[model samples]
Target: MNLIQGYDPDTLRELVDERECAERLAEIESQRSLPVLLERVWLLKVLDRLDEALELAEETVRQARMAGTRKDLLRARVLHATVLQNRGAHAAAAQELAHCANEAEGRGWFGIAAFAHQHHGRNAYEAHDFDVARESFKRSLFLRREAGADDTELEKALRAIDAAERRSAEAPGVLV
Candidate 1:
């Protein structure tokens, strides 16, 4: 697996034929090729084949751990947990991301911690547990801002959490 230099959707063409992309990347295993496969997985998620995307994401996380240093593990964990959350396995996803948060915190990866928080917030929101979402979203936004991804998904999560809170508060105990 190659290193991810950066995430530029435009340059990488966010959605592409996965098989072709994988083949192309396998042709030349550079320090920048693995991210292309990861990008394919992201595109797969966007296309709604979440199971396949989750599989690819898990593979990406595994390969990234093998190929990357501690510095890169931060990004790998974030991506993997994001895929899990996308699959709507909210509780499991949250637990996995919590592990990522702990690892990032131990490694002084504040940025990763922020993203993990945001993913955890997604998990909570999907589970219809607004209180946890509120707290997680708030932390995610704070950390993303500090990490320079001020306009990232973390911010979007904040918006979603706010909307969820409003809806939940108005419902008056619907009794799940």
Candidate 2:
């Protein structure tokens, strides 16, 4: 098994060598622990290996629920929702994001809540529900700011909010 030594998820480099990361993760995945597996799943997502990520993400969620902490479960769920959204499974993704958002909010995990709201907004945006998307993105930005999240993440959320607002403004008169 290929053990990915020396790569810390919390301190992941600004510009990751994703292919190398993925290769290293894959080398030891079968022998890896849950945390490493989860990181691998995320790396695969970054690599746009959605099918593989989705498969591993599902298993991660199941394993997390079975033996991991609540935070672990939340992470897995967020990953699952991301894969679903990337695959255009908007409704399912929305459901997962809503669950994650509610749970994170209840736990005062504002950063996770912000992430969920951001993805929820993306799901709505994909569905053409501009008004709902706009609201969701606004909520996400507010939560992220309150959480003192990274500036880059805040900027991305702001961009999404702007796009949603633009769409809402341009949408024709039709009952939503």
Candidate 3:
């Protein structure tokens, strides 16, 4: 499986074999393509090598900005924001994701918008802002529908909403 397939997109948590990720990383170690770089960033992140992941993510963003398409740049930015979120730089991640989502939406890139919203939702969820998380997830779901996203994507968005709802209900004195 691909490095991305090894993680849950919304949560950025590993969902498959770590050895598989290692093998994939090894397989692509000699590559410098944007796609390869992106996969390396993801594999390093999932493997808990945050330092390497962050460094590679930044390089990937630079590469995407310099030589890749707008969609590629946005995707790189989103992944960079995710790494920031994972590193506990929640505010920075939120700002970057919001910008990415707005840009993607303005450009009619509904799929990317959905991805940004989903990750933004996860950031909010981690920060204990369940209402924001739920709203973001709802927006993601809507965007995914607009983009004709597959069932797996839609279901993930739905699950994120449900999780936010549950968390909101559990938190003391929080009204969602």
Candidate 4:
């Protein structure tokens, strides 16, 4: 549980070995490293081991709260919401993301705020709420750009926006 030895969120997302990440993180569970726990949850989700991911996510949120660290708690909440989103629980995910987005904004954590809004957009897109998805993605992109986020994040936001727009155009009852 070396505080200085952890992967960045972007690196975790880009990792080709999800199972390795999960195992490596789990090995440090005794150390109670919040970052490792959160990353493990993300890796589990990527592996489509939703039940394990959800369990770890909930535990991470609880541990983060008990640790009295706002940053860790915010990160845990976002990861938890992502598990819910992956599980197709859109409403719950959206609710969590909304709260997360507001909290991150109030705390001036623009990176987390951007992440929250991006997932919020993903939830909306899954629910076929293209307009809401588009707006959320736009907000996310703005925040990411303002915060000097990496190009990967900006590209992801743009892709979400494009997907929402394409969906909106194809939906019935839309003007041609």
Best by TM-score: 3
What are the lDDT scores of the predictions, listed in order?
A: 0.66, 0.79, 0.90, 0.82
Better of 3 and 4 by TM-score: 3
Candidate 2, 112: how far from true, in Å? Answer: 1.1
By lDDT, the better pick of 1 and 4 is 4
What are the models' TM-scores? Answer: 0.70, 0.77, 0.93, 0.82
Ranking of predictions according to TM-score: 3, 4, 2, 1
Write candidate 2's Cα lDDT for 98-175 as tens digits: 999999989999888998888788778878887888788888999999899888878777777777777778788879
Q: For model 4, what is the error of residue 156's alpha carbon versus the real structure, in angstroms, after optimal superposition?
A: 1.7
Per residue, candidate 1 scores C-alpha lDDT tens digits across 1-176 of 33323322211113445565456545543434566656666556655678887887777777788886775666666777777777767777888888887787677677878777766766676677777877877877777776677564554655755755774585567677
* RMSD, every candidate, angstroms: 6.7, 6.5, 2.5, 5.2
Overall local distance difference test of candidate 2:
0.79
Among these predictions, the greatest lDDT belongs to 3
List model 3 lDDT by residue over 27-115, tens digit each: 99999999989888988877888889999999999999999999999999999998898899999999999999999999999999999
Query: How many residue pairs clash (N, CA or C atoms closer than 3 angstroms) in each of the candidate models, in the order given?
Result: 0, 1, 0, 0
